[model samples]
Target: MSLRISDAVVWQETGEGISLYHTETGDFRTLNETGSKIWLAVAGGGGAQPVASALSREFAGTDPALIKRIVADVHAFIGTMVDQGLFEESPA
Candidate 1:
């Protein structure tokens, strides 16, 4: 599945981490290191597959199993963000 970043959401990078603000719902979320990377990948307008591929290349020492696990984790995290109305969902 692909992710669609909501237009109503505003994201900012702070010294601590990245913050995501939902204007429509008046909610906020903070992303840690891994989350920040996933958020950046999604916000870059690429989908899950592309994000997985990017992660694979970036962490060269990661085994295939670990890469897959990370991809699954990213997908789950994206699902939560979508459920919270932080982004739109585009199935692929």
Candidate 2:
């Protein structure tokens, strides 16, 4: 149930940030700032926990509970994208 970026797809930074396109489904998503950051991190080939840790450091002032909350939110967001086939887990 983890969400990860699809390595097989190609992304283009457009006028409004970036959009990811899946040639298979012809589905694309335009990302806002937070989404863009997370997308870049996943595209860079790091797993979820590392991204969460990086997010905690980037935001700062986030206590443990808040960090967990943010991580949960991130998971939810990514989960939705994955469910929609915007992302896929890497092969083991």
User: Quick one: best lDDT, which candidate?
Assistant: 1
Clashing residue pairs found in predicted model 2: none
User: For candidate 1, lDDT tens digit of each residue in 1-92?
Assistant: 77878999999988767898899999988889878888888888878778877876677456888777777776788778888897687767
Q: Indicate the TM-score of model 1.
A: 0.82
- lDDT, model 1, position 27: 91
Query: Least accurate stretch of 10 residues (summed lDDT) in model 1?
Result: 53-62
- Regions more than 4 Å wrong, model 1: 60-62
| Candidate 1 overall lDDT versus native | 0.81
What are the TM-scores, per candidate, against the unseen true structure? 0.82, 0.76
lDDT string, candidate 2, 1-92, tens digits = 34466655679777776788887888767989888888788777756667777886677555878777878877776777677777786553
What lDDT does the true structure give each of the candidates?
A: 0.81, 0.74
Top candidate by TM-score: 1
